[model samples]
Each structure stands twice: as structure tokens, then as C-alpha cells.
Target: MERRGTRAAVRTATGTVRRPERTATDEDWPAACREAVLGGAGLLAALTALDGAAGSLDPLRGGLWAALAVTLFALLLPPRVTAGQGWLSARGPLRRRTVRTDRLVSVRWSEGIAQRLVLRDDTGRRLVLDPRVLLANPALWHLFATGARTAQASGALLCGATALRQLTERAEERTARTLLAGSGRA
Candidate 1:
């Protein structure tokens, strides 16, 4: 009987563990994309300059020009993601989109070469993002988690909680693995 009671307490404690809300600032940038853009820009700039100094439009010049064009576009068009109390917004060179996390009714994982988070809110406003953006930032994750929890608690979240929960689990697992590896215990 005592062992059963202990197990129940442990279950209750772990079952109700809630992820805190998160917030994002304007300066937050996706680390992976930034690295690619910066590295590409530097390498392309060097190649383009070298091609120009060689005094001929050679094959390398054409390739460098094309690569430089792509790099510049990526550098200038990086997406800016910001998360607030109940919302997450993404702004790029072309457009800005916002998602009301509190109003989310469905969350879908579009997995492929790159994984995407597809969220549809109650008001039909949709936002697609790379989950790494949220998982990479704790404050942003907290805001999203709190909003989702509110929706789930209020019965406003009709579906997709499973997806959210799975993401949260993945984040936790990754954190655990990272810690263990760092400590040489993995």
C-alpha cells in the first residue's frame, strides 16, 4: 500500500510538470541560417574579388558571381523571429507573419529534408517555422509552452497538443543527452 502511494505521488508530480512561457526579442536570429549566410558571404566575397583582379570573365568569375548573388540574398533576407506572451512573429525581407499561440487549434510537423512547424490558430491565422527557432531559445519556448498550456487548460485547444508535447519531449531529451555527453557519462 505504501509503495502504491509513493508511485502515485511520483506519477502526479511528473505528470503535471509544465513548461514555462517564453519570450523573444528582435535581435534573436536563427543560429544555423546565420552561420551559413556569414560563411558563404565571406567566401563568395573573396572569390568574386579574386575573379575581378584576374582581369577576365572566366568560369570561376561566373560561378563566383552566381554564388555571391545567392549569398547576398540570403544575408539580406534572413528571417527574424520574435516571440511574445501569447504570440510568435516572423519577419523576413519579403513579408511578416504572426501566430497567436494561445489560439492554436492544430500543430502539425511537416518533416522532410528540413522539419517545419505548421501551426493553425482558431482565427485561421497560420504560421510556419522551423522548430529549432523555438527549441533553441528557452524564453521563446516558455512563452509558447505557457500559451499552449493555457489553451489546453481552457479547452480551447481542439487538437495538436500531442505534437507540442512531442516537441517538448524531444527538447528535453536533447538537453539530457547534451548534458550527459558533456559530463563524459554518455
Candidate 2:
């Protein structure tokens, strides 16, 4: 069999990139769950103390407690990426959202020392996600462009349309090459 290049080609003719699946490790689940539980307990305790000491606490005591609670909630809610039924969903502690493969607008790597996947929605919102946070084999950058493209096409949240358009144009040449190759093979 012929050896394929390290850089996989994304074209209509070639199959879409299949990201490796991952299962949460025993440690992963428990650690995240424990953090969430601890954070909740801490927030509850702080809020109760603030309420009891309202007269003595700072004027901004309520706001401070609220902020702390929000922060704790976010930390406790683990973010997860799930792939099934022809769609990829990013489930975060605060919210859960999904995008189909066809809705993807574009995916690309952000230019940085610690590279990340910069995904754009149709309305031009950009989400810079770290691969380390996700449970997938492909580098996080690889998923950004594809996921954006898929999300866009599927009418998912249009968060960064402007950024997506700019990035797509910049990578047009490379994308064209892949498309052409795939077309030829097909």
C-alpha cells in the first residue's frame, strides 16, 4: 500500500477526517467530579457565611459570592466532546451545543506558539479551543477548520463568520490543491 502524507487532504472526493474516539478514564471522571463537588461545597459555604455576616461583610459581598459561585460551577462542570449520529457536540458545564459535519464552515490552526483550533460560526464568532481539553486523536487544530465548516453548513451558532472567511481565503490555495487531488482520484 502507498504511504499517505502526514498532512491529510480534505476534499469532497476524499473521505472526511475521522478523529480517533476516546473514553474517559476512571481517574478522569472521578477527578473532574470531585473538583466539581468540592467547588460547589466551597461556594455554598462562602455564600452562607456571607449571608450570615451581611452587616459586617463588604458592600460588594453579594457580588463577590455570586462570582465565586459561577466560577465554581464552571470548574465543576467538565467539558466534553461527543461524536455520534453524524454529529459532534461540545458539552460544557454551562451549555451544550452540537454541530453536524455538513454544517461545518471551516477549521484551521491558530498562529501561536501554543497552537489551538480556531473555529468560526456563521455569524463570525470564534472559539479557540485547546486540543488538550478534548478527547480526540487529531491535534485540536485539525478539528477547528473542519468543525467550523461543518457547524456553519449545519446552521450552527455563527460566532465568527468574519474570521472564518478570512482564514478560508488565506488557506484557499492549500485547500484547492486538496480538492483538486481528491477530484482527480475520484
| Each candidate structure's count of clashing pairs | 7, 26
Best by lDDT: 1
Query: Lowest summed-lDDT stretch of 10 residues in model 2?
Result: 20-29
Give TM-scores for every candidate, taking all chains together and pairing residue i with residue i.
0.66, 0.39
lDDT scores in order: 0.73, 0.53
Compared with the true structure, what per-residue lDDT tens digits does model 1 show for residues 7-83?
Answer: 22223455774444335643446554677667777677776677778877687777867777676756655577777
**Which segments of model 1 are wrong by more than 4 Å?**
1-22, 25-40, 43-47, 57-72, 75-78, 178-186
RMSD of 2: 13.3
How do the residues 59-172 of candidate 2 rate in per-residue lDDT, one tens digit apiece? 487667767777877766665554443344566766766544335444555556775755443444444454344322223224444655656666763455665666556466
